[model samples]
Target chain A: MADAPAAERAATGRAAAAPSRPRRLGRRILGGAGRVAAALPAALVLLFLAAPMAVLAISSLNATASLAFPPSSLSLRWYAEVLGSQEWAVSLRLSGLLVLLVVATTAALGTLAAYAVARGDFPGRRAVAGFALSPLMVPEIIIALSLLYYFQGLGLVNTIAGLWLAHSVVALPFVVRTVMVSAQNLDPTLERAAASLGAGRLRVFWTVTLPLLRPGILAGAVFAAVTSLGEVAVTALVSGANTTTVPVRIFSAVQFELDPSVAAISTLLMLASVLVMVVVDRFTHLSEAL
Target chain B: MTSPDPLRPAPAPAAGPAAHVVIEELAAGYEGTRVLDVPELTIRRGEFLSILGPSGCGKTTLLNALAGFVRPSRGRISVDGADVTDVPPHRRGLGLVFQNYALFPHLTVAGNVAYGLKVRRVERAERRERVAEALRLVGLEGYADRRPRQLSGGQQQRVAVARALATRPAVLLLDEPLSNLDAKLRREMRVELRELQQRLGITMVFVTHDQEEALSLSDRIAVLNGGRVEQLDTPERVYRAPASRFVAEFVGAANILDGVADGGGVLRIGDTVLRTGLPGPERGRPAVLALRPERVRLHTAAAEPASADAGSGGAASGVLGYRAFVGDAWHSEVHLAGGATLSARTHAEPPPLGSEVTARWSAEDVIDLTTAPAEEAR
Candidate 1:
């Protein structure tokens, strides 16, 4: 340590006496080459992901006749149009209502299922867990078609109840998967300790198990809400004219005409998702919960 | 700290040996692999009984069964002459302290101690008073507001014990509660636990793998092996007169020497006949003599006594193979000329390597370790 400064000065003197220009250039090039190569894929991915949102926000503010990015004149005309239209208003209300129901239903059912899989020692517990999570990995198109046929056979197609149920099914696995992560982290001995202290089954669950699972419940609720609001395939198959959700309305509208109001709606939905994520992160440490 | 808890002014439940806990034909297993089987066992009131064994010896399983956490497949467990075999853990009124403490992370020390009372809907005033008393009993009077994470390891252990004791349950069950603390803290807590048990005079069923803890704390120790009790006796008796080979080896460091039984309470080993307190097995039967290393004395060859009485448990000449100074005692491995190595523990350093020395033990100090045929209960 005492000779550190002398060693550093000798190295510096040697560097000064060498051909520094070519070495410096080569070093810069090598470092820059690695950086450039690493940044290329990330840059491309960022652009691809952000471009559509950029277009959506810009076009939504356009005062021109067509939906265009970098509008000739900017205004809030599309926002007013979407918010004022009867169809958009009703569809957005329905989607909001359906998402609330889905979040509640999925959070409760998924948490219970997760608790069973995480804590229970019954036979086929692994099978039940895998089955509960399979819906997430299954293709949406298959699930939508299957639901279409199944709901049709049950005569429940095109009903508001049916739409809510479909969204719950689509969002169930996200809730279960996150909640299970938290539930598995819980020490089972805590429950046993509570029982030893004379707490019965219900009391133990309410006082011990439920309090420990709060963060997981909050994270799962946020994920389920966002996933349910954005879901379109199953809603399209199960919802009717009276039960059309915002995403289903946007799907049909895009097929018929390019509307600036769609961009406005997309921007609003994006803002809402961002807000929910922020709230969830602040309260539950969403990263840790997941 | 040595004074008894101020909370208990009297023995409210008749302190002397009143109720006898009886277990008959108990068996428990997981996934059809038998973990514990006890033919019959009785725990007397006001006595601390420790189930001592290595891990996987069904010690914890037996404790769980007694606490009603695990159901015995084919047995009856009774407390105070009442059958509690079918009762759940909560209804059985047996307190359990988990190995990890298992304090409710969300609750304060006071709240944790108040849990059992709160569950039973005890009057709030009484609950507060009891919590205070429980905390005081464990010497944590002002720590009610602190979270379990805020306390030291020893304090957290005290809180766990306080929580279990708050209910004044019939029998307290503890599962390796001191294993989480450092060596010094574990020793301190062991003393505290023993004092509390004596002061309260409540029957306690403790499960641990620490032989020293069991020897120091328990009124009686049950040495378990392979899902059965190998020996059950008072600490002194178990240490002094181990009923089987497992008990002798597991409870302490013992040197087992093969010998032939020479009838009339003596063992013939390598031209030396050891006088024994217990009767020997069949004549000339190959028997084992378990001698505590500390009980055997190592003397230099020059100091050896006359040779005629050497084989009469008085002495045996051997070359000292190795010597180690372990702070309080010198541990030595002495090689007998008959090719048997006997360990000797002494207060002084052993003679130089390969030097001739005599290893000797009082016949009364050596135990006759005859392992009974283990019952195939499984």
Candidate 2:
């Protein structure tokens, strides 16, 4: 027991004090080879993910309405048609509005739920946290069927409110999960310090807790927006003709009509997602949020 | 340092200076296991009091009870004759400086300082003035616009102090606030903190496990052990006249001696006997006493013994086991004839290791702890 500290100091001193010349050179060579080895797998994964999007982007430019890869001729007519059509435009607008509503609803609920789950020690707090993220655990088809049956009885089916409600449920799990991570990372001492400085509970929450949790809240909101914008199973079951979102419209159109227009709209949706991420990254350094 | 304007009117003189904060029958714990039990403890106004103890010794529990963070199952806490036991932490009007300097990362130094004022709906103009004043007090006036993360650790600690002081709390509570700093910075901050506390005349309650910090900074220290305050007195009394064995050993280096009192102003340790200044207990009674290392004097074995009042030991000679240089003094360990080791601290060099030496001390310097209450276990 008496020799432990001496042994530890000796070990640390050896590690920090010296590295032989040959060992240092070997390390540098190994480091360069390791970098290339790591990059190969990462590059392959990126290509695998990007290949389908590249094909869809190219197919969207086909002059003929038929969807084709390596098209004999290319033009922007399909993009123009998809942008100009009134039906497609309405579906796009509805989807955008629904996404905004879902993001707002989920963000508010997620933050509150995450705060309670992370800081509160009341009975069944773990159960409450589990329930918040249960939507992601349960199969989406089950939730879609249940919402369809429940909304029909209330005359909510075929209404914009119904679509908004369904999309929020689908997006809520993602927002709450992300915000929970942020809430857990937040230092409790900051809140205590605020309280000690004569700030009341509500004031501390507003000035300290909420502002510090902004990164998590924002990342969660982005996740909600993306999830709502692409939600299909629940929207398809609960939404009517006027309430149809872009994803639901595309789902139906693809089953009946196959054309370069579908590929063009798909490409546009993908571009919109990329643009949103870039804007979010510029504002909040999205990397830290995750 | 410039003395800032008085933060609040000094506590009313009618209540006297000694009862600024009072705790009566305070008992707090977690899950039915008692961690603290204080029958009564009073903190004087404008005094720096440190609750000193080892880890899990309930020093923090006592501080939390004072800060209104820990709800004592049984107690009445009052500041200036007003009961605040039921009040929430925010309404307690106490400033707390945490060990980690919990500065708001999202706010600038000025913003963090202005938070309490803003919460109270203070006028914006006065808020800015107070914020600037607080920054100046902590020597951070020009760094108001910097975020906490932009500052170094020491700078962030000063910001936390500034933020807490901006509110002008009735009593500032510090929870081991200096334990995180490096050794050199910790010493510097210790002096600065003492000066600030004196200048502001604000009642401060500091909690720490570092005995040196408590001994150096506190006007009065409450030395707690095993969820009980073993001694509460001024630093000189606590160190020089420790009331219990725990305080004697914990506060500084002490050589504890266990022996039987011979009822003749002497203590018998094995075959060796040492004369004591205090009246010895009844014959055949077991006694425990403390003798500080610095109080012990070392002399060569061949030298003539000093006067008897100096408690010169004829049979106390021992072989010098080891000697260590402790920056300012030489500490020599003497392995006694009775198998007990006695350590002595002195400025003058002593005989080389393995040489024979006699250890001596005045009888008046012995601290009798035989009657001190035994430590209670949880």
Candidate 3:
């Protein structure tokens, strides 16, 4: 009975001493230094992303004939010039058509391939899936060079169809990867339940499978459209004199002259990319796609 | 056995149309490993039959075969006298409710219920009416516009049922439909599902590994093991008169005792002779008896103090090993002199451990089997 009181006293003393030590140390070190450590890098990353966009937006309104930071005058002359140009208009039209075609074809082919790879069980399924997505592993320069030689040999050099095909090939892997991730996450029992409910194969695909795949298809289409619109490496190889996309035209202009027009055009492309990203983020969660 | 006269008026509505589903000589496997080998099974029309087994017992494989997901290597599956061996799942006109209640996430509750009718090219107005009627049957009439994600788990399950019933298929298959819910919810859903089936008079096949679920919901249960039906009988028959040791052990908890027959309708375990109501095997033959725990009575004193010398008292002495309170009953494990243990469930609080107690049971409660030798009884 005497030993019990001593033991109880010691235990209570230890319990009271234990929490205060950690609490005081946390307040002195982690509560102060740890917060600074967490916040500094996050602040740096945010500034790094925002500063360039802010400078670009401000410089776009510059009235000077040459590109400069902290411009003396602000005007919309560059915007008006870009919009008034027939060359820019024609290139914009071509880019629009290319984006539309690329988005539609990539989405259709990618969804089918994704469904097959993720859900279908057949011989050589893994090998076929790997082969379909192998384009992403190769460097863009290698793909462009190979396609250039291949198209030249086929007598399809410098044609719109050649550019369309090349862009689709590069864009397809992204769409397929995004859609396949979503498809793999879906529950397969849903398909079985659909079948048992008197739904035929086609009906099940349309009613059950397609609705669940909408977010994936939307994300992949946006990615394919944006990539096709701004693609340069592959477009450079296959674009003819008569068929010049906005990126190819901008590349040529930059090579010839260091002028504000290129900055203006690049700013336009940047805005378009941001716009497409925002639209995608609105409909489909970008984090889920990632 | 003499066949009943065909000319005589049949009783009880002719056994409810004579077993519409006939599965004959079915052998199925996955990736060259045979999983199911059911020789024959016949399910009567409008019957709520459950295939009960443990995991890896191929009960799900049997259900999948009936659902047309698995093609048997050698068999014929017929429904209403028509061979459906070559038919695909959709063409077989069967309704299935998955364990997770796989309702369509994109469509509203009404759209999901109308999917089958629309597939069959029902008129738009008629489709709407049927969808409304089906939802009403499941008591979800006003939830037609809600997507599956908007509803609770039980509501989603009801929508799945409504969708399957809208098609009016020849059979309904449920694959552990209530396994995902909480215990209380599972109980309520079981009652609701059983009531719905009886009200609709639908031929339903339910698959589950839970023994209580099988016994409570099914009119007859086909207890399966190793891909074959061990016993197909009414729940009471399967529970009370299991045809084999496996059935007796798997259906309910049974304490098996090894005994030797004395060729005079008597069996002995150690020095205790048992008066088995059933006939004994040949002299010196090995046998086993299954005794349910609830049937055994426990007494604090030795052989009631007055009937110790009488062999017909059906009493045996053992030491109380452990006692546990199991809500409405006390479960006691008693160890006999020969190191054998017996479990008995009693209404009274069990005696303390290490106390000497006598276990008593009636002769009619002992189920005797002579199929296997004593050492290999299990």
Per-residue accuracy of model 3 over A1-290 as CA lDDT, tens digit each: 34643564586775342345665576568567988999999999999999987787778788987667887898888888888999988888889899988899999999999989989999999987898798899999899999999999987777777877998999998888888888987898888888887778888888888878878888888889878988899888888877899988988987886556666777888888888788778876775776
Top DockQ hit: 2
Choose 1 or 3, whichever is better by TM-score: 3
TM-score of chain A of 3: 0.87
Per-model C-alpha RMSD: 6.1, 6.0, 5.1
TM-score of chain A of each: 0.85, 0.88, 0.87
lDDT, model 1, position A104: 92
lDDT of 3 at B148: 96
Better of 2 and 3 by TM-score: 2
TM-score against truth, every candidate: 0.86, 0.91, 0.90
Output the TM-score of candidate 1: 0.86
**Model 2: per-residue Cα lDDT at residue A161:** 91
| Model 1 misplaced stretches (Cα beyond 4 Å) | A1-51, A63-66, A70-74, A123-127, A153-155, B1-17, B31-33, B150-152, B261-283, B305-313, B370-378
CA lDDT scores, all candidates in order: 0.85, 0.87, 0.82
lDDT per residue for candidate 3 within B279-373, as digits (tens), equals 66788988788888898888787436455433442456789999999988999998876677889999988778998888877767877645622
Query: What is candidate 3's CAPRI-style docking category based on DockQ?
Result: medium
